[model samples]
Target: MEKVINAALCFDGNETQKTEWLDAIFSDVDRHYGYSNSFEKAIETTAGLMPQAFLNRVFQGTEEQQNRRSFFIRHGGIRRSPLSKIDVTDLIAWCQQRNTPEIWGLVASGIMLWEKADANENGYFLTTSAVTFLEAAPDPEPVLHAYADRVTPSGWTGSRADTMQPRADAIAELSLHVRQDISDAARSTSNRLAMEIERERIRDRQRDEDREQRFE
Candidate 1:
C-alpha cells in the first residue's frame, strides 16, 4: 500500500530524475531489505495515474533533508512501512536495527509527512504525486521525525477548498488550530490600539471638562 503510494508520488516528479531516484530506492529494498516481492514493480507499472507535483514536493524535501544528514541519497523520497497502518515508533526502531543509515531515516520521515499532510476532505485523497512519493519511500521513521520538526501543526493556514460547501467544515478544522493563533495575535493588537485610543480620548475629554469648569 505504501509502496504504491510512493510510486504514485514518483510519477509526479521530473521524469528523468524520478527514473534515477526510483532505481536507487528499489535497489536498496532488494539489497539490504531483501524485498523481491514485486511490490515496487507494481507501482512502476501503474505510473500513468500519478501526479507530478506531489512527487516533486516529495523529492524536493527528501533530497534536501537527506543532504542535511550527509547522505548522498539517490532516492527522491523516504521509505515506508510494509503495513498500511503500523506504529511509527516501532517502524523507526525496526529501521535502526536493520542498520539503516541517516538518509534512510529522512526518507521514512518524508513518507510519514505525506501521509499526514492535508488531503481532500471528501476522499482523504492525495494528489498522484503524493501517492507516487509514498510508493517510493524507503522507510517511515526518519520521515516522521522530520515532519514533527519541520511540518507539524503550526499557526493558521488555508487552501483553495476552504470556501466551498463540504470543504468549509474541513477548512475550519484545518484552519482552526493555526487560525486561533493568528486570532490571538490580532486580538492582542486590536486591544492595544483600542486602549491607546481610549486613553487619548479620555485625556482630551478631561481637559475639555476642566476648561469648562474653570470658565464657569
Candidate 2:
C-alpha cells in the first residue's frame, strides 16, 4: 500500500499518465476495501501517514537538501519550486496582508525556521513543531488560543486575532478529520486480514483431519 502511494507521489508522468496511475490505484483500493465512496479517502489516509518533517523537507528545504532526498532524486529531482523565496519576516508580512487562514496554515505546515524566536519578539516566526502539533491535534482550539495568546501583544484583542484564530482552527480541524479517517481505515484493514488468516487456519486444520480419516 505504501509502495503504491509512493509510486503515485514519485510518478513523473504527464497529465494523462498521472490520471491513469491515479485511477488504477483508486480502482485497486476500491476493489480491496469495498468502499462505496470515492477512493480519495483512502489516498488521504495514506497521506496522513506521511511524516511532517518529510513534508517540510519536500516543500521547504533548500535546493541542496531537496536534491539529497532519495525520493525526489528518484522522481526527477524536485519539480515544484519552494512556494516562496522570502525569509520568515517577509512571509509573515505577506500572510498578514493576505489574511487568509489557508495560506497561514500552509505556512505553518510547510515553513522551516533557521532560528527560533520568542513569540513576543517582533517578526516572530511559527515553528514547525507548533504547526505539526496543531495539525494532528484532535481539539485544536485550545492550542490555537494558547498560540495566539503567546504571540499576541498583552491586552490586545481585535479583529486580526479573531480572524486568524478561526482560520488556524479550521486547518487543525481538517487535519484531525483526515487522521481519524486514516485510523479507521487501518483498523478495518487489520480486521479483514485477521479474518482471512483465521479462515486459512481453519481450512488447513480441516484438510489435515480429512487426510487422517482417509488414512485410517
Candidate 3:
C-alpha cells in the first residue's frame, strides 16, 4: 500500500484535539508535527506528498482505534467540524475556487492548522480555536524577515514589498549545505561497509594461503 504523510498543528487549547483526530485517521508513525511555518503548511505538505490518496470526510477505519485515540482529548473539546469535513477533495475545491497556481500549490502541498481567535465586545481577549488539517502545500521557500534586518523594528505594516528573492537565495545556499552533509554521510557509510568487506576478503585469502603452505 502507498504511504501517506499526515502533518498536524493547533492552538495550545486544541493541541490535544488535533492529535486525537489525526491519530484516529492515520494511526501510525506516519504522523508528524511542526514541519512548516504554519498549520496550513503542515496540512498542505501532507496532501501534496500523496495526491492520489483518498481523503474521506470521516475515517472509516476502526471505531476501536477512534475511541482509543480520543483518550488524548479528554480535557479539550472534541475536534469536530460542522461542514463536510475538509479532505483532499475540499482542498482541491479550495484551489479551484482561487484559480491561481500559487494558491493551488499551497492548498495542494500546504499543511495548515489554525484556530479562530475569540472576540467579543469591549475587545476582550478570547479563546483561540484553530482548525488543523494535513492537506497538500506549496513548496518550501526561504524566510526573509524585514524586521530582522531593520535597525529599529516596530509593528508590521503587512504591505511592504517582500524581499523573498534574497531569502530564497539564502535558502538555496542552506539547501546546498544540507545536500553536502547528506552526501558526506552516505560516503562515510559506504566506506565503512567497503572496508569491512575488504577486511573479510583479506582474512579469507590469508587462511587459504596458510592451508596451501601446510599441504606443501
Q: Which candidate number would show the highest lDDT if scored against the true structure? A: 2
Ranking by lDDT: 2, 1, 3
lDDT for 104 (candidate 1): 44
Which scores greater on lDDT, model 1 or model 2?
2
For model 3 the TM-score comes to 0.19
Model 1 lDDT tens row, 1-216: 656555555444567665665565444544443333344434433232332321222234354342432232223223432222323343344444446455444434333333223454332222233223323335333332332232213332342222122212222232222445433433443344345445645666787789899999
Candidate order by TM-score, highest to lowest? Answer: 1, 2, 3
Q: Encode model 2's per-residue lDDT on 1-216: one tens digit a residue.
A: 546665665545455664554445434433443222334433433334323322333333355443333222122112221222224444455455555454454444323322234455323334555555455444444434444333322343333343233323323333334566533533443344345445645666787789899999
Error of 2 at 170 (Å): 19
- C-alpha-based local distance difference test score of model 3: 0.31
Number of the predicted model whose TM-score against the real structure is largest: 1
Tell me which of candidates 2 and 3 scores higher on TM-score.
2
lDDT (10s digit) by residue, model 3, range 14-47: 5456446444444431232211122333343433
Candidates' TM-scores?
0.22, 0.21, 0.19
